[model samples]
Target: MAIAPQWEAALQAVQSPPAQRRPGRPRATGHPTDRYEAKRKAILDAAARLFTLRGYEATSVRDISREAGISQATLYHYTGSKPEILAAIHNLMADELLPRMNGILQSDLSPERKLAEYMRAEMELIERHPTYTAAMRHKRWLLPGAAQEMREKRDEADRILDAILQEGIDKGVFHPFNVKFARLAIMGMSNYIGTWFSPVGPSTIPEIADGFARILLQGLLSASPHR
Candidate 1:
């Protein structure tokens, strides 16, 4: 996924090379920055898994340290505090996801296409990173510092969805359904995938996304409602 302008620091940290190695040394396996970023990503992935399985409140720095195969002090060097790690997990996802959703809101696609594409994009993200998705969804209100702005971004997403639904109504592609309720229905249906989606499952993410979209766009009744 293209990096969103919202958070450039992590991407920069990974991309920027650090020229730090003694001339006579054995090259230290790779670039120092690459090593740093790889280790950091591992730490975050470990934390995401633990946060998803053990729950954030029950997990600790020591657990993350052990999971990452590093000392507590070393974990601190990569990620300052537990809260910061949590914030980073959420921030990274937001950086990759929110921009795409925002773009969909402004895309030239028809309303039906927009909603379907939006659902697929979102489900694909969740399917790709189910651990982080579940971890972030759990205790979403626990964000600290500037990360609290995530709540605002989430609210903005809500407005974007509402506008898309409104566009469908205005364009005569959909009946004038209650936007709030429709939004809730779709959001609930999409989010539940985090709990049950499996790579080996009978359905792929695109299939699940398309199926859910079809259910919303077309009623369950294949013919007239049977009384």
Candidate 2:
């Protein structure tokens, strides 16, 4: 089966991971004491770089195994395939990111303020781990189980945003729009940052977050201040 050209980049990128951090139930709150987690992270980082530089199909498990200083058997023990590695990378990101978002959602800040915080956190995470961003763009055609799992988690994030937007609309603080579409547009804009935005660039992550929030708050249509 052939993937579309536009989707190919992302499919290969998914061989890396998403730009966002993953969230989940916390097991041990502290960092790993052993070298296992550290080695795993190093492998993932190296794989991300390799996948980005060379197409996924062109990059082999032997390449990652060699780059990570681990044996092919060890790499297989950690992750079965490229897609599985991508899924694991995303799971790691979500585990780091979602808990923070959940905390923000629980805070006393106004809906608008919460949204701004979420955007900032999101952009910062993307800046740190951009491979995840590329993977997300080509998520649809990924290995079925892992891809669906990722989609469900992503939907959870959207639900959080949707709730915030709904709250603002109820309080007459936000412009009314189709909730699903608005959420998609907002998230789509944020998720694509890996393709163009760079953490080392002149424009800082905070600036990008601020700009996105500003656009979300102020639509292109002129508004009446009198209202």
Off by over 4 Å in 1: 1-35, 140-147, 219-227
Q: Which candidate is the best by lDDT?
A: 1
Residues 1-227, candidate 1: write the lDDT tens digits.
12223223323332322223345535478889999888898888888777766788888999888777777897899988988888878777777878888899999987777887788878888766766776686545465654567787777778888988888777667776788998888888887776566566688878888888788878422233222
Q: List ranges where model 2 is wrong by over 4 Å.
A: 1-33, 135-141, 220-227
Score each candidate by Cα lDDT: 0.73, 0.68
Task: Please provide TM-scores, in order, for all candidate models, with all chains considered together.
Answer: 0.77, 0.77
Number of backbone collisions per candidate: 0, 13
Q: Pick the candidate with the highest TM-score.
A: 1
lDDT of 2: 0.68
